[model samples]
Target chain A: MSATDAEIYATRSFTETEVPMIELKGVSRRFAKKLDVAAKLARKLGADVKEEVVHAVDHVDLRVRKGEVVGLVGESGCGKSTLGRIVAGILPQSEGQVLWNGQDVATLPGEAARTAKLRRQMIFQDPYASLNPRMRVADIVGEAPQVHGLIKRGGFDEYVDEQMRRAGLDPAFKRRYPHQFSGGQRQRIGIARALAVQPEFIVCDEAVAALDVSIQAQILNLFMRLRRELDLTYLFISHDLGVVEHLSDRVVIMYLGRVVEEAPTERVFTAANHPYTRSLLDSVPRIGNRKRAFATVKGEIPSPLNPPSGCHFHPRCPLAFDRCKVEVPKLKAVDSLHRSACHLNDRA
Target chain B: MSAPTLEVRNLCTHFFTRAGVVKAVDDVSFTVDRGKVLGLVGESGSGKTVTGFSIMGLVDAPGRIVSGSILFQGKDLATLSEEEMRHLRGNRIAMIFQDPMMTLNPVLRIDTQMIETVLAHEKVSEDEARQRSRDALGMVGIPSPDERLKSYPHQFSGGMRQRVAIAIALLHRPELIVADEPTTALDVTIQGQILAEVQKLCATTGTAMIWITHDLSVVAGLADDIAVMYAGKVVEYGDVGEVLDKPLHPYTHGLIGSVPSRNKRGEPLRQIPGMTPSLLNLPEGCAFRARCPRAQADCVQRPELREWLPARLARCHHPHREEAAAA
Candidate 1:
């Protein structure tokens, strides 16, 4: 079955069953830098050189229900993008499993595997880099449907036309190349391409970060509209908290490759349970309120190669204590749904 | 009132590209009194940076200040020769760029760069210059200025690097400092700290400043006055509170409303439709008319920036005061 049909079927199934559309169980990925075998062997003999292993995504557990937009937020090297890639099945997890429709994506075979591929898609951060410069907008937008044979062989143009219309692009502009379109229009094409597959879940990795402030709003609204129209689920990853608060139904705040806090969007913004989340919230500049002093986190984000000892944020957390430095705090529920991995959750 | 320290009169800067002569800055005019911060705000390619560069006599070949005069302390800066302008550059006017590395050299130590900037403008002893550099670094909130001064640019974090760059700019204590989005790359806390230091410095030393940025929120907190730029023209100019609280131009209204902070949660963000017109092929009339909701037949004739009220200037034939009051 195609992604659109599967989405329709899932909506009907969801009316009776309560299974989440996607679930990630302790997914972690580590990448090793390229090195010669001789150099690797020499390093084992204490040759004053060490092989580097980047623990990009470390033991993240998350779940997204049907029609929910969950935001994954963190700084540049905090592994948010890596986790998004793992969830999209674009990169394999070194440890743990990904469940799509309660079936393990790693173990699925044939039609089930194909269905998993069609059910999820990703919208990359850079619209310019994501679209092919040499190809026409029609070919770029219709490639997914054409490759999957969802649309008939000769119906590529019509398929592209319909997707463009759905994405708020003029059909006549489909003949033009990606370079011919503006940044906002090009992002619309990227969204159209993702929607062409009719995926149940989409990972928007900093989707609007590259656009200007005004263009960013337009693109964000388009995403909101598409979510309502298609009943799609979104894993919105961004560094900007304002955008996250505007888009997310639930938010997962990450730091140094670990999920520090996860809560409903409104609660996370109003009464944050984690110090990092609080600091991130305070960092955003507001218009009317003048007296709110921003809490600038001291110390740079530690390199993932050598993260802080216990809680990764202990080095920079204002409320960090000796216990925070000695022992790792597992994510625990502070309330019914809000979860945070900080030792001082109850303390003022 | 004391004579305005920096008075700009009908400044126009144009770029001679292969396609045509692009009017990057058109008849822009504003004044900054001593010890005051005037913010120049606009989106990318809106020519805010070019205005700063033009005031510093930094506009190069194919791009020139076509008309108008830049009068700093009653002297015309546009008429100065290359040699005379070079002497005035770091001595009376200095600029802090968006990227700290643009002002700081990666190979040189922080102390070397800062000390040299001091010596470049004045005949000072090495020890005196070093002391001044240390003071400048300390002024910007870089902890342990002595130790930090010994390190290279790469040794510091991005925020710290920007601080070091800002410290270098402060070494000379110029009459005017043109900061072009210097803190846009910084985290809000660092940006706040820098903003505080910049404001304090301006107040203490009677230094006039032009802070160019795309973020209106930052300007709202820092600047005394603001000029909103669009398509290389000042769309609105007024006191910061007046301009922000009651923006008089359609472009200014769209910009202030479009920011994510201004809207409520869950609502679709308010956006000005259409992208900024390409400078290479600018429209003949009001540059914003193509995207403006209230465009009229009069908008086809380019409107000149005229004083709409006391110390308030707008380039719209029909400004937003009446609509704003009604709303």
Candidate 2:
């Protein structure tokens, strides 16, 4: 039942003429305020309840071509995960269009919707939290394919075994509970759960952030191997710039709720346009740049609820000018595929 | 060099669990010199944090230091009474945790906690203690120290709260500090600032430091010497540059090689195979044998930490030395 060597290392097929697998047009997600006990009491007493909103993702436009690995890099509260979820159809955007395979996923019919749901899956940051503790590894990975009717009623064990092997997990441990596995193994189990449904697109939201450095490498390798074997596309979201650079074909940098820069991996590293992007690259601790003075941004990330006027990065950007204060910088192409949102880039 | 600020030798700490004994830290040894930093680098469950706690005398029940010497100023801390350890701890020796909330009481104001920290160790007036607290905050780059001191822990940002904890640790001008992943929760920009301040403080005050973290990149710049821990053992130890640039042990080598910065974009990572062994039941011989590519039949017997090069030590039977490894 284990995956054959050929099956594990199957060559991925990509064509230049293929359309983007996922697209986000003017997407924004806003979460409403939750009332505390005091606030609830106040509302019961006829006191006005304030309406607070967290603009997690704002006016984002992204495209993921078939078999592409697009990295979405940002600090906490930058809406990287929210945007990823919106693309995966986990969260309905407050405003905008999420087109999957050139059609809006929201408008898909019953059969089409089920297929779309199975074709795209989400892999969370903490595998321990994502996996059900009560379920054995066998049920965790095998249940989805069965519910989706991808596997036969009696062929569950073989299908589960094959998925676990593809995810670098031993089929022998299928009977063990989620708690019985190590962090790396738990992550593999999560991946197996995702892969069992034969998904073509994955939204990996900090999937390797919780693992040890050595274990991080193992899981990252498995992810890369799976992409080739299954021809899967990924929207890899993480805060680690170096990791994003290592694993991605394109890198997109987000500040506040919007992407400040998007470019091919090499060009973004070599000749970055946005000041925020430059500082982010500089902030990373590299072995080659030993004892180099840290070029930290001036302040912490502003509250996404009341983000700054115009460019959200203008407050910390060293190159901020008068034009950056009143006018929001539009994403402009620096090269054919490289785009950056900055008033300075407009001047350049 | 003058006498080291702290020296740990043959340290073995274990936790008695229902399943079995967890050898959290076993026969680990290292030293931190005056005004220098020693980075204790490892992953979760690698015993890096336990080693710090053992030195600070902070390990709670179910965990005990079985045997070893934690020599601080030529004194064996392991043999010291709880009261004696207390006098040395927080006064001459301080520790910082990964979470700032672990050190700070959420209900207390910043000034009250810091003033108490200074007053607890020294015979100073309230005004003098407050002044010292302000100076400590300023030293760590907190803006408007007096104003910040008035606010509570919740009012300050995550990075600022950590800085406050560090300020309290520095109030007494402690000779040694053990910081366990203090910057792991902060953003990259904030992490940079904190690392700079800590490095500067060590230089100016002649305080030695043991920074425990899982991030190797942080150690590459911050530490004068590095100790790579694996399954509660000092698998490799030497100058940071020497150990990282030309690591002898396969584990250390693989760790550095796996980092994204080390690999070219789009190229498959040269990942070390297998996961870290469980502390409760590690593999026989070397705990890392299951993952190490160079493991041989010789590895069936445990290898002791030996000097592979001058001042550089490694615990491996077949280390990748520039010259042939001496048997």
lDDT, candidate 1, at B56: 95
Per-residue alpha-carbon lDDT of model 2 for B71-150, expressed as tens digits? 99999999999999988888899998999987899999998998888877789999999999999999999989989999
**Per-model CA lDDT versus the true structure:** 0.85, 0.88
Highest TM-score against the true fold, candidate? 2
In model 1, the fraction of reference contacts reproduced equals 0.41
Query: Cα RMSD (Å) per model?
Result: 4.0, 3.9
lDDT of 1: 0.85
Model 1: per-residue Cα lDDT over A7-48, one tens digit each: 343223123356678988898999887778888788889796
Give the DockQ (2 decimals) of all models: 0.45, 0.54
The per-residue C-alpha lDDT of model 2 at residue A111 equals 89
What global local distance difference test value does model 2 have? 0.88
User: What TM-score does model 2 achieve against the real structure?
Assistant: 0.94
TM-score of chain B of each: 0.96, 0.98
